[model samples]
Target chain A: MARPVHSFVCEIGRVCSKAELKASEQPSALWVGVKAQKLPDLCLACLQAGGVFDSAFTYPSSISSHWAAVYVFCVPKLSKPVVLFSHAKQFHSVSAQIPAAVWDERKMREISGADFIGLNDLRPIIIHPESAKFVTNPLRGAHAPGRRPSARERSAGHEEPAGHGSEYGFAGTGEEGEFQIPVGPVHAGIIEPGHFRFHVGGEPIHKLEVRLSFLHRGIEDFACGRPMDGVLPLIEQVSADESVANGVAYAQAVESLASIEVPRKAESLRLILLELERIYSHLADLGGMAMDVGYYASSSRFATLRENMMRLNGRVGGSRFLRGLVVVGGMARDMPEDSLRQIRTSLRLFSDSLAKTEDLTLSSSTFIDRAFSTGRVSPEVARRLSLVGPVARASGVPCDARKHFAYGAYRSNAVRESLGQGGDVFSRFMVKLGEVKESVRLIEHQLAQDIDGPVLSERRDLSKLPSGRMALGWTEAPRGSCMFLVRSANKGALGRLAIRTASWRNWIGIQEAVRGNITADFPLINKSFNLSYAGADL
Target chain B: MHEFDALLSPKTDRIYADSPDPAIRELALFLKSRPLSPFSRSIAVRMVDCGSSNDVELEEGLTNAPQVDCERFGIHFVASPRHADVLIASGPVSVNMKLALEKTYRAMSRPKAVVAAGDGACTGGLLAGAHGVYKSGRVEEVIPVDVKVAGNPPAPYELVLGMLKAGQILSKKRI
Candidate 1:
């Protein structure tokens, strides 16, 4: 389904629904309110409307102000799209309406000392259980005995968590039919480390609980007041494969805060690299999925093709994953014509090889047998958890942040989304494959195009003191849309910056997908969904 | 012919015409530059899993999985680190894992080499200064390292290259 011409009509509809909520004149900013009472009611209406729930975070809107829990919303058809919720200013907890908002709410309450009532399962998702309790952001006049918060605080914080004061222990009755098989926070693969506790009877899995945070870099706390340029390298580490996407999201957030515009050429170059990044990332997942399902010929071919593309990328971009290529306001360098032509040729070869891989995979009966019904995520669950990207698309939820949100010249159609039906492993596979083709097509169209402009934008001179400010930037990364909220206290660099990658939001979907699946099919199911450990751990 | 044109001869076929793989071609050239050894039987290397980092553990687990029919790939992971030809370690050299790494290295026969498999192992790149992590964040700091495979966690292909590099190092070592 496509947006009807003159889609401003939907904007009008949103304004009518939330009369108190107003649309700002800024490029794309939506303003809404809690009406002092109906926080739950407003959240419920927003959740049911099928909007992409971006992230939930806490910022003291004003430096001296108490912590305000914020929920970021990406409403595709709304005039005033961004919706925020805070339990401190309004309710205790804002997660009653959103199932995926649990981790964010718990994290907010832990650090800022906010309270979130009515939130379910508020565990310390990032900090270790035994860490001591020191302020997460000592920059807000809070103090860390050391330069960084001590582990004593973080360890105890993990056990109690910010929001969850009470959590029940998990133990099952000893019976002949049940046995527990624990598989790591340190997994066996290229996969990110996250502990999985499974209750199984014979070969069938009855229950599974995931424990992540093995690679926690404390990106949010560490990012406070770091120079803008210094931030990209840190942001890029969120997910190695989706670095550019995180770069774009962070850069855009800072640009919007300062009201700076990225030059057209810079924008075009950004899209080109973003699409290239999308292709390689998806190829890794596609090949991994095929191999997971026992189609080695198809999987190995995919790997061979993937390696070739990565080498080609390293030649053109300097770094294979396109790191150090992006900066605030624009790209670090321009794409030469020879490199563009080489990329075009590389794409064609990749497309051709992809066909052979597809044929081999499609013909292999054993491959299809494992993937078809394995890790089937119900359409209802997709909606309930607000699934995104292929996970959302496969489950018959047609949401693409790039297409709908329209940022970074992606609206030009150089890159379109690969979508899928209600959430299943096959749906995720089809969505990734669709995206690969779009990436090739997008890069091809941009080959001869020229943008008349500068590559870099001027920076903000933050020497003067004033009231702290808040700004948000997001990009539709290959994994899904990643959002960043940067808030600078007049005293220094932004006191608090929250970076939420798509992996954090989609982790619950993985748990849901494995519910009915057999224990033997875990790897196949995990590969298909392919959520990130580093991204989620942050 | 121009230098660039001369570079095209090795990958003259139109098959991969878009761009030639200089890496593979260079790898081939590097091999060709050396004289062939009478040692037809390649080194049999075994990766050890001492409950180390994710990628190392995964590659270690993959040792028993049916090997891809690709040749010149004789890397096996031994159940006991004592039987391992190569102690492929990945970690920030954690205190708990330190004894294990040393035990595994000591267990390996002489002329054995150690390949540190990821940035965490090579430089303790990310996990520096953490409570659980040791003060110094390098595998070499704890143990004498032969080859370092650097990456957040090196990709599987890179891991293969690092091991092969260790194999080359192993060939030169005197028993």
Candidate 2:
């Protein structure tokens, strides 16, 4: 079924004159290659033509003369996504049209040494300012031709020379009574590090700036030159909580590039695991929201439910976090009938307890008072930022990939998208609660289907697999849309891998959401949109 | 109400008993014999994630779950390193965070002990030698680690056991 948006993209290509449209093997996505000079105009036309910016990334092409700047857009009524590419010798920028493109463009500039011409915020992203002198982009010399500049030459161009006191110059509101509060990079809780700067006048926050990438582990660089199978573990490590989603997205991308058809049973099992992940992840957020509100009773109850789910995951999948379960072609292991039975029984128990906890949490006046209207993000801000997953759903934007893209088992069984209109902490909390219930129903429905078949597809030798094929794989992770673009090179090694996690997209929304809220309410607001630093940084 | 009651009285004893596999049992016994055991049993731990997938952090959070309540064993998570007796570090030591890790470790008192949680912190796990990762990605390279809990993300029981073992090290050092 060709989506109407595909026709619109084709129309844009014809009008632009310098663009060539190519059909992607992956359903619901068309690739348009445009000339570098026409890219800005074409992208502006795309936005005018009703395309919402999804993500933008740059990767060195195997041809070596130029790097490819890929911009993904979600066109309304298009079943397939549209990706516009423009080749550049050195630099190009698109943040002038779409503000969300700034972060991705900055990252591309730093990692690939491409000059983004019109990017206003050019501060160093992935590489820390202090370490910029010592650490060069790992991918700098890998594919680029000619003698690469020495580390000194590369470091000289980047902003903020080493040891110039503060790593980032805090841009303040400059009000007379404005004071700054810096939190994290090393927080008091058991969480990953990312620094947050809040400019506050009394208790009200005037502006908030976030500095991340402390967990940049060179994952994309590490994937290069490694055998395809060897990289699944690394992809799964992108974010511990979203391992199943990331693994599935990476696997699907690889599978699509290789034209591998996974057995029906494997798809069903994947759906089950993905839903289980959603349940546990959302439960953690629910519990955290309660804890932040000082509702210990409901928080502990939610924690108990989450722990039960984790234990069930251990019994069913052999890992509490469901690691090493998903592979490129299919699942690494199959679920036995007895394990399925146990999961069903445990899920029923969990559902009943979760209902009680949800009731208790929503009924509490104090919990409601704290979470009701705090950290409100209007529908406009959410749409402008292109927020995804529960955060967007909470703001009443229907952006669920499962419903829109319908990959894997979702194609057979439709997913019910849970939405809330409040656009506040309470709305996000309700949306998560609603999503948890939906996931429980999805798991139950999936388990009832006939799921007897080979779990793992026949393994193809990595060296023999075709090379230089690019494919996009995406999944609706609990937080939002987790997408992966994989380019395979000779010998089954990855040429380029670009990831857009839900946290990466929704983090900017938090900066806008916390405005005007009191400093004391910051933790509550932050928890409502609980994003991952490692996932975003990577 | 009965279900709530049952949840409150979890099967923690059974889980705890099954947890002290030969390696942890030895550590438990060693902890009991330390001269400063009384003061050491109740220890405050500060966690610093150098560069983990946050899986280790999830496991660490579960230690506070009612099922694996480490507080009953006199172990608690403190906000500041200065007040902490044990430092629990998870994930591979990323190059950017190496200095912060060192500063955090130095901020702790002299009798402090470090427990490297997760395979990442213990031996750099899957991320070892990655370009952005520090040397070996292990906590021991930057600071002395008394106990290493090994798992992609060590289970909550394992984390509890590792922290206890670190508490024992603190006790031994104090003597």
Candidate 3:
């Protein structure tokens, strides 16, 4: 099975002159380097040959000029990813052929100073336009730390910037009475900050533009010089709820780069922790959706269940958010056997309570009325945008990373992907609910295995390992698929750490889902998607 | 029918822990004892997310959850800064959000108290000295902080305790 995929990648390498297949430790991955000029065409050819566009990022080049770019594609029937690498400072934009590459190329153009010809929408996404003077490109190696604003600039900023819509060229139908409504960077509710602009005529929306990165903390730049083992806490902060998934993803990238095999017991414990994270994370989404529709009883019940899950997490892993459990090689320490037993026992009660909550929510006419056809994302748009996790699954696109790129315990225990037919708010709700139940099943299966071995691998320190090795780690987070691209630098420090979360991929889907939705239903629609601003901004 | 039947059986999952932190209760009593304290009974709080990882916001929302339920102790999260008497700001104030955070602070009326919630808002946490944020990433650097709740992201009980402390300070300011 792996033989054909290697030749297929080799065939791709043959299409462009002076192509070389880079040696890799993982047999599942095929890394090929081609001429920089041939990148756009080669990317199109890969897309044409049934490969799904996964992620693209640029890093500072060691051997050549300023920048080197890597484009990742996930081919069907192959467990690992196939990556195309090129070292260049300039290239034709592949966004012309693959729409998913647009944001990636624009980001590369801004941060790494790479020139992508024919790229549209070159406005700064991460750095605010007003502060562009002080911080030009933080990702550039020689770029200085941004200076504090002067007193004059501080006084100038006292006045609120007028019409946030004008900065993003607020798109709308120019017909009479079609006015613009701008909301946030600071929202009404207790949620992460991101700006939303709605172009509306009366109640119905003409268009919606979501401008994010208000939470961009330069996480990639922060990770630049840090040792591989020390960055788990930083990765865990990517999104609090998805901490374990992100940590595991970063860990897998480092472990695979160093070619370390995690022990059996560690793998089992990791699976339990990962599934518990998914259950708790999805519970919030389920509860929030109910709360938005004014189903307070059901919402409170779901919150109660989520609180129980978090307490269970604290009891088992010692952190409510389940941080500090997953490290570079394997588990940080062994989970108490009694606590594992306690989880297995309490899950039955949890399952029963959830069933009742689901019954109360689904049976409510008010919930059905608000959610049934509201905030619809067609399967076509989901495919075009490369939406992942539950949002893509709700749209009937089977794109679960757990199923496609199985890692650790997921390799032995096949996950049953819960899919929905309608891409509306109700479908997303149903899909998430289904996933919570499946997570319980997955956890039960892991505990039943009774595997025992050393939780942490002996070869923990990667500082002694050679550098310049790069690998991709992916996990099926509750929101969707999260991919972390890690490159080992000199003395095991991180050369580059590029993250693409499920929230980042699915935030674009919200813009598509809210096309014709009424202004009133926007919150309900938005809550259903529950995209994370921190994940997207980073 | 299942919903109706379940109602008759009445399975209550209500958490019976320390409903209000003992510190919060003691503070509430102390505030009630003072005649000059305007916010002894209730205080409206508006949360400003200055670029947190969303953990602080999650913990803030959970303050309203049944297990923690800070509302019974006179904490209300308002929709507008104008309605709020207390401002709870979180995150390592990012450069992009510096203007917005400052504007939000300005929007609140005088006699308003600000509580910097979470490690990020208090000391910039993990992102301190990172390029994307303003100096040290503390909310105090951008605005006056009357109270500081410190944790990776403070738990709900800790957040409520911090807000109560802010209320206690707000009363002194009023006098």
Candidate 4:
């Protein structure tokens, strides 16, 4: 374990002053402290070491008054992720070089009021610029750092997002017949609220600007000062469809923070729950892709399969969305013998039905024609944005967190990182189809194992964990890989909780995918990626 | 050939049982027996997600799924509020989305009803008074709600039941 950390440190030594690099180790990751001036150089060095830019966020320092930024990178050959920390009040921006870091930096700017010196796009990512009336940047710890708000104090002096205006200056083409079309904050579908501005001349789109954050509810800020046990509900709300995945990720972070090992039975049950979520979530995307193309028959069949899947989930976990089952240390409660038996039978039926539906859908020539080349997110752009999950896989990027950053049951299961080369809607469809089969096979495999034991591990007093101890939890959610950065504060509370959902990374893919596609195919392309507005906003 | 075979096989029942859920069955039977009104027979709904984490929206979509199929009960979700008879808003209404919620409510013509679906909308759920949200985060705080269907997100059948009640209220308002 120390070998990889030493190698990473050795790599960092070549680029910057070794004296300024202070390295420390944790059970799961290596933490290094760097001067703010050295952030860009360290980030570049990490990237050169074959590290993928995982996530970056700003948190208030515990001992000092200064705000610090942590940039995390997942490097190959390292047993754990590498985290570099620096005080970020007026730090140099890495977004100028690493385009993937743009949104993270923009969010850091708004939340912590951190000034990134050389950053170009300084637009408000969460709080709308026109409605920036706040006593403080509501999320910043400067006002009442580490102090929990009482019931009555929750609303007073809090910033209310006010304006509903399309005021962001979208770069437009000055070509003849070019016109801009803005859609939503409230859209035409039953989907979540987001705005998409298109620069279209007639048939093809010149540029597409996606403005989200309409559903930003300050989930991360609200998690601060709350007890570790109390924060799971909020994490579950980050994206409802990915509840089990987010819960498991957060639980793993907390479990790792306290060094609690989960029992095997609990781990197997969690695997079942996570894969069930993937199957249902991917089903929605498949159905929506077909529905958008006017193929109602295939779409309805997919929806039926999804409904049956959800009903099975309801039977197993008592909630259609599979909530309240994955608690911090282990399973919230043991799955009954009957439920497991039911699950096995249901999965068999599900796979058989799924095979029929996949066969039926793929056999349709009209469906193929519509989905074939409609929304193409090239492999180059996918890499540039650091996209994850099926969207990345469809574009030939193969960045599944389950396979790359293996956690829980995935570590032993040896996931096949399903790949597609087309980088188009059909490729994404095929990728999701492949993943659904994989998830079913995985669940079946897990169920066949000896998984009978205590569901929950013995509860520990989490407040005993050292202050400022932080851990990273990553999960391959249905949409993609979502991450949780948990930093322990005094008295078991989280000082700062940063969430980066797959939708956050993949939302940019939609903007690129929509380019050159006709206005009518926009919905099809958007459905192909199926990025969650609330997940991205949160 | 595979498509035809799959289509021919009865995946879902041709007709649902009369009362799988007693509550939903009661509501469906009541709606069936109720006199014909503009909304009693059919209600056009526009769902606005104020800030509930997309769960309520998924349930709303599932209401259209073959198992729950709210379409059989004449519950049609529309694209525009102007064409809607009931405005279903899910919340803890975010501060950013409050104005849009208000605008959507105002767009619907009179003789309209509002259904606050999900615990978030009805009582602000977990994120009640958190930052980036208005006071209490309830739909009624911003707009009047005739029916409040509460759950973390009420299941599809529950939402359909709530809409059925909303249709009845819309009928009364029309009179």
Candidate 5:
């Protein structure tokens, strides 16, 4: 199903011309398409293409149709972009192609009445067996399901299928002694809930399957009738860390579809906010990587740095994580002169501290020992899976949405991506750290060049938006290039909003990276990827 | 090392030098007054996570997920709902996690205290009443919450607040 064949000119990557590699996408071999019946073929193409089998989710409401399965792909470059899309109706499943899609398909099928015709694993993903009657896709609004639930059925995420599979086996090649250790739908950590089953022999895991959906908040359905502007706050709720990214994506989608343009100053200010986000996010991950390696000093020091960044966030954007600052056309309020000065001061502070922190972490033998060789992802694998951001750069895949797809003020600047070769945890850490420095550089550059004028653009009233157009907006967010597709309805309100994050595409590749690694190293490895549960679940 | 340690040891750990917050000192004294258990494990409850903001990490220790010193002080994090006598719920309780939270609570044999951790879980700090939320802002909206550890994200000590409150409730029940 994977499509191939695309030739591009150097310098600027404009698709010179495209030949279909297989079927259905501009870059054919890169993204494969299949009819619902060709689910197994889809899986074979993905496995054959050597990309990571990322995730499968159901929109529950598909463009006025009550249900649909939105299967996502994170393949490397053949022709298609990193994310692949396919639409399927209710009672039909596509898990036959990719084994990891099983749990997601089961949940989608149970809740939204979708199907997985050839699914080997179809146990209820989350909802209890007794709660199976509800056909409630809380995330989507008014999109009528093929069937409705009985009075006994309750709403929300709980809608487990009755009497399902009693046993499931890991697809292992050899090893008679290999066994599976199931971790959680509920775990000991202060994090999101996911069911992790690790098939292992001794310490090495042969196979791993992650069953996620513990954080699905039914956001899509909730935002259905809400005004176009009303969606930003709700989108921010979908993932807290990605407030800037998601907000920008939503705004971009709205702007593109509506054809709205803002002042130059607002654009640069938006870039500043975006860079602040990247720094804090990368710092958190760096600290996490240190913590995973048992480097308490490095971890604590980095945490202090991260905390300072958060404080800077509060000072600049009003809220700590830059929430409420982002609106549809432009930002809510312009940055106070004092706030800009404060930001400049903090940038210097961050730069000074980062250098010292780097010395501490880099010089620490233990920290390097822990991160240097853990969870090594190869370049070929990175391309196949279509991994993004630091993960892709680590494997020498130089595809950064920031540099590739120019948006905000970034179209004018020199944005250099921090890349690595080994694709290990250290590489991921280096990329994130280097990106943080680059963010500082961005903030400094923007500050040096004054941005004067109104933050918001002069546009039609949000309530009175124009109709019948679609726009795609993206920003190089903290995690990666977050994309948003916004389609307008009859009125100014958005008819359809498809939001995808780096975490969603990267998570599957993480499961692949875990192959052959020790179970104990999973935490360090997972930290390196640092994918978002809220982003993926959405 | 000895000289610096000795210099800091006497006045440094003499109750006042241990913490910056008076609340922490108060809590320390409270702990000192109790019969402390003794035991420790090499592996703490270490976790690598993908969801939520870094609020969880903020509420816990930065070095490890959270070195709760549970077994070291009559405290223990349960492996199973049956094993866990306490239910520590985090975040604003999105609709997806509500069932898992409820199921985890139900599976515990008996005598469970649900500690709502993080600002979002406690009072839905910022993202309240929005689309992504399950219902109301708090986790209690989805389940019966016993204690709330509130902050933008409750500091580790603040996290201890809920568990300690639960401990108080547990001891009272036992008595």
Candidate 6:
């Protein structure tokens, strides 16, 4: 382990014991293994000493009867990241210290059926209580053939005895002059569904509660027992807009476990695809903010630019959403010189149009007034919630995975972390705009480098991969940092897979950001964060 | 300003189309030759995402982008199901969202058509038999679907064409 990680473990060891803490090192990060009961104390001590909680996940352990809980934390000024893990039948929760851990622990409990004691919010994060009875925990031994119930049976189980609104209950503020407003599991727009409950006094929101997991498709369970190669397609679909990032993250996990080095050419190509994905994803959020603020012209212009980029994605990778392009070892297919030329040409056009759209949007007083000073998340609150991506960056936290934990081509290429001061809607908007421009520069830089060597690694047989190995993979998704934990079973099948997307961590920040803002400003604020329901739910 | 001017007259050559498919070509020729039928010319669509990764929704949004411009052909996405002539549902219908899908379909007036807009909705695609997903993950299992647009997520023009086909079905049902 690195000195910083060793010292941090020593610090945690003082609270627990040196014998209780086990340290191991991975290529990208550090791993410190601890006993389950000591997790709460260790996490609290780490957070108190300025350690940022990156992600926490749980998986069934092959060696033990108990499940293993992994919590990744990054201590500032430390060059290497640290992942502290512990094994237990049930783990103590750290949600009281880090609010983001609430959702992580809830999801851990739901999937593994592991108890999380002292969890402030015990409400089901992914599975509805009504459907929970019928649907078997896919991670458990109940995953037998022919176990899937018929649609008729499933719907019958979900039928409420008339007058019962929903299975999950929303917490109310219980204060005078506060009325609850419930938004959709089915919204008005062409977006995925998740319910949002707001306790409001007139137009100002007092407390907001978000109920997601409406789009949960059991992705983690579906990936289990499948061969390493077959899981890429499933990972790509984890969040459509972030297909490349998720795919890269999953691939990196597999590569790290297998100790396969991605060729330099493939690394550069992967970086290009990742930056392109960032460009299109950021464009959507930028345009959505405009649409929420009624700046239709700028929004349309952004939409046009996004479409052109998606088209370019299709032309280069054979899918508009860049699906089927990233495989386990390296890339699924190589980018031809013709495609590179085309992408470069399109990028020039895209940059000019983006500048114009940014000018048009910023020039509008109505858009400016609505966006500025709205949905402000203070730096303290952002750090407490452990928010990532543009949302955290906008709040003045320099938490870019590319810059901090440089992996793949990022290890060589320079990455500039875009920062924002206000953490308001306008700040988020500017951050995204700045990121899009930065992504364009990154793509150009990658393209300027020599594109040579084999795109796909030589190791083609995934079934022959060694088993009983565990590794962590992470990439800077357009939304934020997307991390994947992979454990290979004895038969080269996925023993356990846990994914913690950026949206899953950042969704809690929205609950705090929306407070004290008017109900009408909710849409603008929500669009600024643009958290993913499917990603979070999965 | 120059970019805005160029966007006003975006070239149609880049728009996605199945020109190689004789049936679609014949249908296009037929629609072009005839006086535009009310259903064929103008239609409002309401999209519901039951349990998708949201790729379908992205493509659906892009259908209205200046390049595709399905609105020029009188296709618009309305907020309410009551105002829609076609309901385009995406994703494999999850158990949590199955009732919502049924309600949205029921809310549309009679003589309406439904388009299953992605492989997930049409046949459950990758998440066909997962534990969290509804059985088979097909939209038709929960509601009547008039058109099945198949892709991991179908391209923007493909989604538009699928809705147009559903509009054709709505016109036929009226007759």
Task: Tell me how far the alpha carbon of residue B114 in candidate 1 is from the true structure, in angstroms, after superposition.
Answer: 4.8
Higher-DockQ candidate of 2 and 4: 2
Predicted chain A of model 4: TM-score relative to the true chain A? 0.94
Better of 1 and 6 by TM-score: 6
- Give TM-scores for every candidate, taking all chains together and pairing residue i with residue i: 0.79, 0.94, 0.92, 0.94, 0.75, 0.93
Model 1 C-alpha lDDT per residue in residues B105-171, reported as the tens digit of each score = 7767877778887777777765444433444557786678898877754544456556656766776
Model 2 chain B: lowest-lDDT 10 consecutive positions: B11-20
Output the better candidate (1/3) by DockQ: 3
Once fitted onto the true fold, the runs of candidate 2 whose alpha carbons sit more than 4 angstroms away are: A1-6, A18-28, A133-166, A459-462, B1-5, B8-38
Report the lDDT tens digits of candidate 4 across residue range A1-538: 3776788799876777778988888866788899999989999998888888888888776545467889988775674688999874468999977888888887886665546788787666786754444213363444332232334543653222223244666777777889999899999999999888899999899989888889988888888889997888888898899999999999998988988889888988999999999999999999999999899888898888888788888878899989988888898799888998888888877778888888889999999999998789888888878888899899999788888778888889999889999999999999999999999899999988866888888865787877888888888899888888998988888877889999998887788898889999999999999989889988
Give a tens-digit lDDT track for model 6, residues A21-110.
787877756777888888888888777666789888877665554777889887655655568888886788888777878888777765
If you assessed candidate 4 against the hidden native complex, which CAPRI class would it receive? medium
Chain B of candidate 2 versus the native chain B: what TM-score?
Answer: 0.83
lDDT of 5 by residue, B73-104 (tens): 34544456666556677766665556666777
Backbone collision tally, model 1? 33
| Reference-based lDDT, residue A108, model 4 | 80
Instruction: Estimate, for each residue in B59-169, the C-alpha lDDT of model 4 and write its tens digit.
Output: 999989876678878899999999999999999888778878989998999899999999999998898757766778899999999999989989888898899889989
Model 4's TM-score against the true structure: 0.94
Candidate 2 TM-score to native: 0.94
Comparison by lDDT, 4 against 6, better one: 4
5 versus 6: better lDDT goes to: 6
In CAPRI terms, where does candidate 1 land?
Answer: incorrect
Candidate 4 stretches greater than 4 Å from native: A63-65, A133-166, B1-23
Using DockQ as the yardstick, the better of models 5 and 6 is 6
Give interface RMSD, per candidate. Answer: 8.5, 2.4, 4.1, 3.6, 7.2, 2.5
Please tell me what DockQ candidate 5 reaches: 0.19
Interface RMSD of 4: 3.6
Residue clash pairs of candidate 2: A28-A80, A28-A81, A389-A480
DockQ of each candidate, alpha-carbon based? 0.13, 0.58, 0.47, 0.51, 0.19, 0.57
